[model samples]
Target: MDTVELARLQFALTAGAHFLFVALTLGLATLVAVIQTRATFGGNPVHQGMTRFWGQLYIINYAMGIVTGLVMEFQLGLSWSGLTEFAGNAFGSALALETMVAFFVEATFLGLWIFGWNKLNRWAHLALIWVVTLTAYASAFWIMVSNGFLQNPVGYRLDGGVLHLADFGAMVANPAALVAFAHILSGAMVVGGFFMAGVSAYHLSKRTSEQDFFRKSLRLGLGVAAPALMVTATFGGMGFGTMQVTKLAAWSGDLAAAQAEMVARHGPGDWLPPVGWVQAGGTWMMGLFALMLFVAAPSTLLMLFRPVVRGLRVWHWLLVAMIPVPFATMLAGWIFREMGRQPWAVYGLLTTSEAMSPVSAGQMRFSVIAFTSVFAVLVLINYWLLARAAKAGPAAVALGDRPIDAPQPVLTF
Candidate 1:
C-alpha cells in the first residue's frame, strides 16, 4: 500500500485500540470514585471492597491508556505533520490543556489516591479520587474540543496556508463536540456497568461466598448501565443533524444526495464513508444496545428475588457473555462516527490524503506494523490483568496497608 493508506491504517489501528482502554478507564474511574465515596461516609465495608477491587482494574486500564495516548500525541507530529502545520495553532491549545490536566491533576491525584489509602484521612482520601475522576473527565473534554475542531472547524479561519483560532469560545462550545462527548461519557458508563456486572456474575455463577457483595455489584452495574445506554443511543441518534450529515446519509442508505453534494462542492470523487458497512455497523450497534437493555432491565428487577435469581445460573452466564457487548458497541459507534467523516481529516477544510505526512511507504508500513503489534500485545496484557483481578474478587485486592484478615475498624460518621 501507499504511504497514505498505510498511515490511515496505522492511525485506525492505534486509535481504535487505544480507545478500548480509554472507554473502560473513563467509566471505571467514575465507578471507583462513587463507590469509594460511599465507603467514606457510610463506612460500608462492601463499598470499600468494591472500590479497591474495581480501582485496581481502573488503574491498570488507565496506565495503558496513558501510554497509548502519548503515542497518539507523537503521531500527530510525526505522521500527520501536514495537519499539525496547518491547524496546529488552533488545535494545539486544546491539546496543551489536556496535557496539563493529565499530569498536574489526573495523574498526580491518582497516585495519591492509590497510596494515600489508610495514610490519609478517610474523607481526604475519598476527595482525591473525586479529583482524579474530574480531571480525567476534563482531559476527555479538552481532547474532544480538539477533535471537534477537526469535525466542525468552528471558531477558526484560514490565514494564508494555516488555520488560526478566531473564536476560542466557539471552539470550546462546538455543539458537535459537546454532543459527541456526551455520547462518549454515557457509553463509558455503560461499559463500566457491564464490566462490573459481568465480573460479579462470574463470582455468583461459581457460588462464591461473597454472594451479597456480588449481588450489590450486579445491581449497581445494571442500574447505571440501563440509563446510560439510553443516553448513549439518544445522543448517537442526534449525530445525523450534527456535523456528520453525509455520513448519516450513508448510514441511512440514502447517499445519493450527500455524495452529489460532496461532488458538487469538491468536484467528482468518492466522497462518502463506507456506507453499507457503516449502516450495518450502526444497525448492529443499536441491536446490541437493545439486547443489553433487555438483559439489564430484567436482571435488575430479578435482583430483588435473590434466591430465585441465584437459581437461574443461565442469567449469570448471559451477563458474563454480555460483558464484551458494550466494548463492541463502543468500537462500532466510534467507527461509525469517524469513518462517516471520510476523505476529510478536518471535514471540508482538508482532505485526508493531503493531511498525511510525506513519509515514504516503507516508513509508514514499518510504523504501522510496529504500533499495531504493540497495541495488540497491550490489549492482551490488559485483559489478562483485568481478568486475574476480577476473578480474585475483593479479598485479593488491597484496600490499604492493613492486613486482609485484620479486624474491621468501625467508623461512625
Candidate 2:
C-alpha cells in the first residue's frame, strides 16, 4: 500500500479501538449514575451493589479509553500534519474543548466519585457521577462537531489556503453535527444496555446467590436498550438528509453520477469512495439494529414474569450471546460514516492524500504495526480486568465500605 493507504489503515485501527472503549464508558457511566441515584433515593441495597459492580467496569473502560485517546492525538500530529496545517484554525477548536472536558472536568468528577464513596454525603456523591456523565456526553458532542465539519465543511472560509473559523455558532449548530450527536448517544445507550443485560444473564444462568441483584440489573438493561435502540434508529434515519449528496448517491448505488459530479466540480480523477465497502457497513449496521431490537423488546417483556425470568436458562444464554451485537453495530455504523465520505479528508475541500504527512511508506508501515500491537494489548487487558471483576460478583467489589456481612444495615438516606 502507498503512504496514504497505510496512514488511513493506522487511523482506522486506533480510532476503531478507542471508539469501543468510549462507547462502553459512555453507556455504562449513565447506567451507573442511574443505579446510584436509585440507591440514594430508594435506599435499596441491591441498587447500591449494582452501581459499584457496573461502575467498576465503567472505570476500567474509561482508563483504557484515555490511553487510546492520547495515542489518537499523537497520530493526528504524526500522520496528518497537512490537515492541521490547513484546517487547524477551524477544527482544532473543537478538539481542544473535548480534551478539556474529558481530561480535566470529567476526570476530576470521576475521581471524586470513586474516592468520595462513604466519605462524602450521599447526595454529594450522587451529584458527582451525574457531573461525570454529563461531561462525558459533552466531550462526545465536541468531537462530533469536529467530525461534522469534515463531512459538511460549515462555518469556515478559505483564506490564503487555510480554513478559518468564520462563524462559531454556525459550526456548533451544524445540522450534521447535531443529528450525529443524537444518533451516537442513543447508540451508546444501546451498547450499555446490552452489556448490562448480558452480564446479568451470565450470572443468572449460573444460578448465583445474588439472584435479586442480577435480575434487577437484567431488567434495567433490557428496558434501556429497547427504547434506546428505537431512538438510535430514528436519529440514524434523520442523519441521511444531512449527508453530502455525493455520499448519499454513492450509498444508494448511483455511484456514476456521484463520480461525474465530483469530476465536474474538481476535474477528472478517482472521485468516488469505495462504494461497495461503505454500503456493506451500512447493511450490517441496519441488520444488527433490527436483530437487537427484536431480541431486546421481547426479552424485556419476558423479564416481568418472575417464574419466566428465573427459569429461562436457554434465553439467558441467548442474551449473553447478544452482548456483542451492539458493539458490532456501532463499529459498522462508524465505518459507514467515516469511510463513506472518503477520498476527501475534508469533504469537497481537501483530498485524503493531500492531508497525509510527507512520510515514507516504511515509516507509516512501522507506525501501523506498533500502534496496532499496543491497542491490541490494551484491549485484551481491559476485557480481562472487566471479566475478572464481573465474574467476582457484587460481594467482591471494592467500591464502597459496606460489606455483605457488615454489622450495620446498608446505609439509608
Candidate 3:
C-alpha cells in the first residue's frame, strides 16, 4: 500500500474497533447509571446488588476503551504529522480543546464515580456518574465536529500553502455535526441496550432469584435501546439526507466552475454536466440507503415501539438485524459524501493528495503490516472477553434489585 492508503487503512480498522468498544462504553455506562438510580429510589437490596454487579462490567469496558483510544492520539502525531503540520494552528486547537476540556472532564468525573462511592454523599455519588456520562457525550460531540470540517471542508480559505479559518460560523454551524453525533450516540445506546437486555434475557430464561432485578434492567435497557436505536437509525437517514443535499450543492458549484472553463468554447451545456458521475452516484447511493432504512423500520417499531412483543424471540432477532444495518447504510452515505468533495481536503485550500505524508515504499508497507497485526490482536481480545462474559450465564450474575437465587421459605406452626 502507498503511505496514504496505509494510513487510511490503519485508522479505519482502529477506529472501527475503538467504536465497538466506545459504543458499548457510552451506552453501558448510561445503563449502569440508570440501574443505580432505580436502586436508590426503589429501596431494594436486589436492585442495589444488581447495580454494583453490572457496574463492574461497565467499568471494565470503560477502562479498555480509554487504553485503546490512547494509541489513536499517538498516531495523529506519529503517522499523520503532515496533517498536523499543515492544519496544526487550526485543527490542533480543536483537538487540544477536546483533550483538555472534554477528555479531562470525563476522566475526572469517572474518577469521582469509581472512587467516591463510599466517601461521597448518596446524591453526590449518583451525580458523579451522571457527570461522567454527560462529559463523555460532550467529548464525542466536539471531536466529531472537528472531523465534520474535514469531511465537508467548510468555512476556510487557502493562505500561503496552508488553509486558514475564513469564518468561524461555517465551522460551528456545520449541518453535519449534530446529525453525525446523533447517529453515533444512538448507536451507542443500541450496543448498551442489547448487552444489558441480553444479560437480562438469560436471567429470565433460567429463572434466577434475581429475575425481578434483571427484569428491571431488561426493561430499562430495552426502553432506552428501542428509542435510541430507532432514533439512531432515523437520524442516520437524516444524515444521509443532509449528505445528499450537500452532494448536490458541492456538485453544482464544481460543475459551474468546470463549465465556466469550457462554456466559452462550447457555448453552454457542454454535452454532459461537469460532475455527471458524482451527482448520479450520490443519488443512486442515496436511494439504496433509503431501502436499508425501510428494512430497518419494521424491526425497530415491533421491538421498540410496541409492548406486545416485549419478550418475543422472533422480534428480538429482527431487532438484532436492525442493529448493524445502520453501520452499513451510514458508511454508504459517508462514501458518497466524502467522495463527492474530492480533490481537496479543505475546499479552495489543501488538496487531499497534497496533505499526504512523504513516507517511502518500505515505510508504508511495514507500517501497514504492524498496525494491521495490532488491530487483529485487539479484535481477538475484545471478542474473547465478550465470549467469556457471555458464557458466564447472566442468570448466575448479580444485577440491580433482582433476586438471582431462590426465595427463602419459613415453616409455619
| TM-score top scorer | 2
lDDT of each: 0.84, 0.90, 0.63
Which residue pairs in model 1 clash with each other? none
- Give all TM-scores, in the order shown: 0.94, 0.95, 0.75
Query: What C-alpha lDDT, on a 0 to 100 scale, does residue 327 get in candidate 3?
Result: 42
Q: lDDT per residue, candidate 2, 1-413, as tens digits?
A: 88898999899988898899899988999999999999999998889889889988888889988888888888878999999989999988999988886657898988888877777889999999999999999999999999999988899989999999999999999999999999999999999999999999999999999999998999999889999999999999999989987778768988787788889999989877788878999999999998998898899889999877777999899999998899999999999998888989999999999999999988888889988987898799889998888888887777775533456566566
lDDT of 1 by residue, 301-351 (tens): 887788845667898899999999999988888777777777788888888
Per-model tally of clashing residue pairs: 0, 0, 13
User: Which candidate tops lDDT?
Assistant: 2
Residue-level lDDT tens digits of model 3 in 244-342: 332554555544555454346445543222255455555554564455446444534543433334455554444444444444434444445555555
Worst 10 residues of 3 by lDDT: 395-404
Number of clashes found in candidate 2: 0
Worst 10 residues of 1 by lDDT: 398-407
User: In model 2, which runs have C-alpha deviations exceeding 4 angstroms?
Assistant: 401-413
Cα deviation of 43, candidate 1, in Å:
1.5
